[model samples]
Target: MTTGNDTARTTVVVVTWRGREHVTACLDAVAGQTRAHRILVVDNASDDGTAALLAAHPSRPAVTRLGTNLGYAGGLAAALPDVGTEFVAWLNDDAVPAPDWLALLEDALDKDQGAAAASARMETAGGEPISLGVTLTADGHGADTTDTGTETTGVFGFCGGAALLRTEALRRVGGVPAEFFCYYEDTDTSWRLRLGGWTVLPVPDARVVHRHGASSRPGSREFHRWNERNRLYMLIRCAPAGVAARECARFAALTAVLPLRRLAGRNLPPAWNFRTGLRVQVLTEVLTRLIPLTRQRRAITARAVVPRPVVWSSANPPR
Candidate 1:
């Protein structure tokens, strides 16, 4: 069990793109936390005067502004060197945590020495639950949804918007992959932690409300492109060889089935996105495979402390 001092030791890391209003609300919530904590805001080259606004705050956290937009993975990597605490909490600029959010996550970590990361329950700005529970089948392919106040064990991955991670575990597996600019970065990191003999879970009591797509316009061309590219990257890097094959087959089957199903239901936009995503997936795979180093793949394989078969079975189950 972690001691009292360990529980008190934490640093909050927030990554922002351009949502100044949402970012301000997020910081206000963190400032209201009961537990003593430090905050780090990594601004990803926002031209909307985010730096000026953060500078004007009374009790400001340490802010770092990257001249170029590094996207999600790059912003996380930038804040890593600045994280001096034993535990690090990641919050999206658009997410607001409950007052006792920090305390609950800290307690959850204290309860288990093997806990690598603990994510809080997430709800949408409209009060609908957003992200809380995640279940990956024996294969890396899986889905996530908001939980209904029920505790879950052995989570496949966590939402990067509101998750607390042990610094040592992150260090052991290396930081978040830079290749994943936006989506699936958390899944990649979580897979690494699990393979390194660490556990990730959901803390239902801790809550955060997120304004989805607050940073960018949803369903825009760029949004679809990034989401499409990153999802395929995640399957390649995290899934076991056999599991990847199965997921690929499943994905192909879905591409054929979902479009027709959506069209039948008169949902044109989704069907379009699905078809576009398939094309993007093919291009990304070809480009990524051409690279010789495969740095992310090599890093994951080298630091894996768990047996390949065990990790595979744990992440993928019999269908």
Candidate 2:
């Protein structure tokens, strides 16, 4: 199959799972880019006819259909090897970008030689801003800069949903952390990029309207489990030791007091028990992986070009 954009230097990778209703429109918007970029669709084992639809697209995007759902992190990991382009843009199946989305982000990277990634301004369908970029909290959590009410000028991280990244930079950072399965992977990568002396920039003019959580509902138990577990895991792999330790201890304290709070009627019993059980699972998983996680921490520390304090301070400038 002729994977269109033969002369283009960038490929937009859209990862989808059971998103038949959204994938077509997503691909159509990408194929309509004002910039001459290629389209590559990574179908994460979607059983909802998404793969077939991609195969039949007039744009004839290169499609990789995996046998099992590997989530967004794994899909990107699998597709990276075939990117061949100098840059790769990641777009969610539920997002539709303006015609110049890629062009503007490409211009941002072109203008900023030191930047390894550029985040596009993403808004909800109703035009409310969702994220221009991500900012790191002291406790190892990454929040949208828009949500933090902070300056959006130079963000520390880019949202995985709509962003452009240098292909070489991505490979240098050891690629996406497939172990994450989904959440916090981008923040973890951003941390690595900063530690490697690279910056993530925001391209406010490049915009996309995202139907947030279209594939995975935000409040579901699955979402909570992955979000919490991966947040801690990201801290272990990337955050400074002091921050990691403090956050881990805080998580433990929360887990310990949850049952008492449930008994006191501070938290609804059913929800409380479920929350407590998941926290136990997260703690157990982290404990079992401590040895490997520590080794990763050491490896990151050894290669880091920026000071830990500087990295943390950039995200948390004195207000």
Structural similarity to truth (TM-score) of each candidate = 0.85, 0.94
| TM-score of candidate 2 versus the correct structure, residues matched by position | 0.94
Lowest lDDT sum, 10 consecutive residues, model 2, at 144-153
**lDDT per residue (tens digit) for residues 142-174 in model 2:** 888664332345888999999999999988877
Candidate 2 Cα outliers beyond 4 Å, as residue runs = 147-152, 268-274
lDDT of 1 by residue, 20-118 (tens): 777889988998888878888888999888888888766566888899998878888888887778888888899899999999999999998888899
Instruction: Provide the lDDT at 5 for model 2.
Output: 68
Model 1 weakest lDDT span, ten residues long: 1-10
How many clashing residue pairs are found in candidate 2?
0
Off by over 4 Å in 1: 1-8, 137-139, 148-152, 245-272, 276-282, 289-295
Error of 1 at 118 (Å): 0.2
